[model samples]
Target: MPTNGGQIKTYAAPEGVAVADAFLIYARSVDSEPWIPVSTYAVDVAEVNTTRNEFDKHPISVASFDMDGPVEVQVKYTLNKVQSAAIRPKSLGIQAVIDGDNTITFSLDRPRDVMLEINHDKWQALHILTNGIDHNALPSDSQETWYFGPGINNGSPYGLVTDGNLFVPSNTMVYLAGGAFVTFKLNFIKVCNSGVRGHGFIYNGPNGGAILIERSENIVVENVTSLGATGFSLTTGEAKGVTISGYRSFSSHGNGDGVDLFCSSDILVENCFLRNSDDTIAIYGHRWDYYGDSSNIVIRNCTLLPDIAHPIHMGTHGNPAKPETISGIHISNIDILDHYENQMWYQGCISLSAGDENLIEDVHIQDVRVERISKGQLVNMRVMKNEMWTTAPGHGIRNVTLKNISLDATNSQIVNPSQILGFDYTRKVENIVFENLNIGGQYIHDGMGKPRWYMVADLVPMFINEHVTNVKFILTK
Candidate 1:
């Protein structure tokens, strides 16, 4: 294990509540200076029934650090009164050992962010980041490259303004140096072959979103730490060939989705950390001017903590008149830390609610380890109509597969099981398969019971309405 001193910092919890002093470690690259972790306050957000409410006091601590290449780091934490401990995305193979001082040490490879949990579940989360970046060397001044060095320098039509927000044009590059603290959003509108990247911070005020890529193509946003977007952290609408990597975001506002894709195609989102109040990654069909089906989208190797909503949501919004279809989606190797929602119809860690006459199919969700479902279900696949959003019900949902999904509901009071339902006989869901689906170390198969039809106030374990057909479950020993 790499031993570095004082790189970690601890934040105190509430006045009376007992919490652990979390530690973070970072590996120094010979090519660059030592990485300084960003410390943010995490609040205990209560579940609201209708509208967005104010957050509780900042009782939890979150730390993030960046590193290049591969390295091993150890996180040491004060062991609280606990029964079990786990590092999220167990595929990372993090090893924990209790030191003689009664502290726990976690060892893992770098270039990823993981949530450290004590006992079976608690609210105090230590978000460790091992970020990787390219092109760290400063860029030379050129017509194609727009550089913003230390301090504020406004390049009227090209670079940031006095308030630090910049509207990037097409065929350009915007770079912010290290230690640069800029407070503005980056807007890429109808641009092509452009990128906004840096080690600097992008602070979105409490009104608009941070980054907007509308009707753009070949756009890239990487290695940026974004905080406090009233809207989405990154919103891509009617865009194509968009790639978002090595990004970290935190949103505490209502409807502040991490990455909302509307009618976008050929997208790849990987190696990111998102702690949002809404859906972390929402893939929707046509809406407003963005009118088309979304395809070939892949989101993997990420850590998602939806403090208020779903981690992966799809097919919620679409044009009822046009009726588009969303297909060819793959989500793998994800760690869902915590999902909180009170609305049963909109409660899930992974939800595919095909609404507004859309046909959502060909989805593959594999190797997902959900640490805790605080208030929602494991998986919810439904085809229905949202009276507030959709004009008509969805067409159907078919050929969706869930494999190697494990949920730890040990300390959860709401053990809401998964559901796969269709609207009616005319618009149904079919060809759904589950392989090695284990909840609290128990395999869910056909041997559980008959299909439990859901009603308004009924609380069932697992539901498969009659309208859902061709459901297969292959249990693993």
Candidate 2:
């Protein structure tokens, strides 16, 4: 384990592989963390572009490498104690082929969502024993894919196969042609291990999902666990270094959006936990082969629950132009719990609409704790109707900062903007701040559906708007 600046590798496996016992894989990050794990390294991968080695001196996203390029950087998997037969009966075995230029890095801390779905050979995998069990009577077994640990010999487990199972005959057999559904070029990660021991149920279903890092990336999914799905999607494109943290992107689908900062960037998602149905933590500006933006972000000590949508959503979808580029973003200590349906269609807990004006300056939502908002807006700086595409998230919601927030609404009401709903709305919303915040609620009226914004101290539509500019609010207690 070289020191000076970078180099730490340790893996032990021989204590248990389940009933058949024996496993160990060490280097648990070097004990007390959040820091203290970095050494020097930079053997010259393409002249060391973007400070590749030596762990960038500090916030280099953890997993670093770049010395004269590829050489089987590393790939590992050791399931200490799991296998319990009943793995069906494709053949009861293991095989290998051997090839290089492979780089696999995985790190999940746990909370839910833990999958490794892989089945190859034109979508082949059926050792189905149904339960009673007997993939060939155990004892060590063998099958269509099985490359035992330590050094791994012979075949090496038929290309690759995870958790297992994929047999299609009528379900559109691999799109009805020669068909095939197993070919990973490498770089894949889905870790949600919130402190381990199945904190929530990372993967608890008959059909589970985890290795869905969309396209792929030079990956690192930190302290992970998803407890749900539809969120926790990393997506891949040119594929750059990635780092996500203390995961818990809980979902029920139907727009379940959480921890989805699409396209991909020099990324990093800090301490997380989002329970969503739509927008618990969103950052988009691109689509398809995965574009980019949602920019260099850092979301801190979090806990945003949207059960439906909008706990923190900032998208600049301007049809998909490089996916609306950005500069930077940092949202600190959060604790929002918003409810959705912000009128017409989408809702908000913290929003900034679509793109074009570009330049969504360094954003921040400090020490936040927004609560109880039902089917409507809370902080939506809108101008939307689909302008050019999106990522504009600007129209005046500039140099933003909503610190020490705590908006309430036991059940509903925080409404007030009506009258001039939509018209060209060129947009320019402006330098905003809502310090030591504390609003009671009731002010909605976009067009008479007004239930409340709980207004008592002046509410001229939450302070009118002519594209609104240089705004301020500092209510407390």
Give the range where candidate 2 is weakest over 10 consecutive residues by summed lDDT: 171-180
Off by more than 4 A, model 2:
1-158, 161-233, 236-260, 263-270, 273-282, 289-313, 320-353, 356-401, 405-425, 430-433, 437-470
* Whole-model lDDT, model 1: 0.71
In model 1, the Cα lDDT at residue 1 comes to 14
- Provide the lDDT at 258 for model 1: 89
What would you estimate as the lDDT of candidate 2? Answer: 0.39
Please give me the total number of clashing residue pairs in predicted model 2.
87
* Candidate 1 residue lDDT tens string, 73-189: 444444355345577666578776655543455544456677666665545556655444433545445687777543333233334453545778889877754333355778788
Best by lDDT: 1
lDDT of each: 0.71, 0.39
TM-score of every model versus the real structure? 0.81, 0.29
TM-score of model 2 relative to the true fold?
A: 0.29
* Candidate 2 lDDT over residue span 1-477, tens digit each: 212112232112112211111111111232322222212111100011133432111110012211111111112213222222111111112221122322122232211111111121101111000011112221221332122222111123323443332221111101100001121111243222111111111222123333244443445554333433432422333334456665554445444466666645666667565554566667665555555555667777766656555677765553333335444677786756445453443555677664544435567777665545545655665545553454333332356776765556563555533211211345555666666555554322223233477432234234335665565655443
